[model samples]
Target: MRHIGKLLLLTSLLTSSLAFGQITADPEERGERGAQDPLRSRTPEGNPLPFMQRLRFGGGISGLSIGNPFSIGVSPVVAYQASERAVLGVGVNYVYTRLKLYDSAGQRYNFTANQYGGRVFGMYEIVPKIIPNLYAHGELESISVQDNYSGAGLPVNRTWIASPLVGVTYSQRIGRLAGINLSALYNLNYTTSSTQVYGSPWVLRISFF
Candidate 1:
């Protein structure tokens, strides 16, 4: 009788284990018991589309340097992305320069110049996040010079020149709509008729736009 009772208890325990396994193995019950996953419900390959894939604009100004016949100008720029790694931009600048000429016995004269330009450029990002950007541009400038001396009777002259630019710019991305950029450019061609100033026409550019 005791052996028979033991057999009956083993049979009951086996039946209970089988019932528990069946309940746990149900697809709906297993799903309910599974842990929540935040990233699992995303689109198939896990890359949703960006709000704007390829459009940007920026602009800024530089400090003034009128002495040494050197001056500063403000430049405003706008761009459109042609591809993932290339961008095309256009810019405008308004500039002024002044020279103070003084002779023996404190005789003094002031000369002023006004210039403006429009530029179109292209940028290629080879190493988008690691180094400075490589760029090239062309500019058309309208220049005028006048003497401010009361009796000098200096002629006011105006002319236009085309300047080619090649440079590298370092950019720090601040956010979706902001960045800091610093650059240096060598002006390719400044004809003798453009300006009779002594300094090289290279421009050092800086901006936050």
Candidate 2:
């Protein structure tokens, strides 16, 4: 919940800053609703594209599954354009994990857990290169897992995990408005809870807007 609050506040600040910049009249750029704005969009004499006209929608997937203990998990994100080079998004994370054990006599013991969580994230392009655009990224995630036990009268065990990361992404543009990215991030909250079925703090993304 604390992480949720932090994410909301960060998102609000980012949007508010962009909004303020857009609404404030700039000496060089056309106003948002000004007729000159469209004039600037003309091919030969155009300024950069309008902000709203550049809005993009896209998503990406990340995760892995293992065979031995029968563990599987996935993390997916849905993103929206926040500015010319910035994006904000949400994600759903889910995983199924199991463990098996046997006693000396021949009895078997098995345990399982179902884990699920939510994530909020932001990405901003810091250097606009032709290929392998560089962007800064950050995200907050929360997840929970409850253990499954076979015995009656056993207390249910549940654990919650929070992951926070900040990193950089290198991407090659697919076109004017799309790209494929490979990212390397360092986890700010690197606890046992922040660990993942796949490598933690590193990610790959495909997006368009």
Candidate 3:
């Protein structure tokens, strides 16, 4: 009888130990398999702002001879892309000129004078057919000219001016480091000091991609 009792107690103790072991293992097994959850495999989605894209830096010469004084100018442009449809740009232009006065002879004017100016512009894409793009931009231009000849040499010339301009442009990519721009622009007078008004002009620019 004593031996049977001892055997029964041992059996009960073994059963209790087995139950405790299973209870402790439940959490560890869940932890090892937790990576299979769908939430753990995916990330949240959100929106972000676009970044800037910069194009080429270029300098070129421009001239006009129709009216007023014949002037030649050097202009340089630096541009940064705001998005696929927009660009932010700034430019500086300097002009050297000689004015021909009607009814005045033997009075030749010479000037080392020029205009110093800065402009800020924003361009937006409006059409995208038959070409890679078509864009329109508006700009504010402030120009200050230094008259090089005065008095007995030549008559004093009018200088400082500010105006607004609207333009349309198209661009096509050629090869690496090569592209082209076709553009037209109109200048509007916003200040009283402007004389020898300028009209709309067309331009074509070649670029490198």
lDDT of 1 by residue, 1-209 (tens): 34334434543443232210000123442355352211211222444323243334456653244455555556566655554345566777655554567889798666556566677777666663344343443333333333232234666655555666666766554533345666676667755543432135666666543
- Give the per-residue lDDT digits (tens) of candidate 2, residues 1-209: 34334433543443332211111223344444342322211232334545654433343334333443444444444555555467677877665555566789988776555578888888887965333257798888777755443342377676777767678876564434445556666666665443333334443433322
Best by TM-score: 1
TM-score for every candidate vs. truth?
Answer: 0.61, 0.54, 0.56
lDDT of 1: 0.48
lDDT of candidate 1 at residue 29, scale 0 to 100: 29
| Model 1 TM-score, all chains together | 0.61
Ranking the candidates on TM-score from highest down gives 1, 3, 2
Clashing residue pairs for model 3: 177-208, 177-209, 178-208, 178-209, 179-207
What is the TM-score (0 to 1) of candidate 2?
A: 0.54
Cα displacement (angstroms), candidate 2, residue 190, comes to 2.3
lDDT of 3 by residue, 1-209 (tens): 34334434543443232210000113333365452211111122212222221344444443232444545554566665555467667777554444555445676543234456877777787864334357786777777854443333666575777767777766553332223445555666633233322212432222211
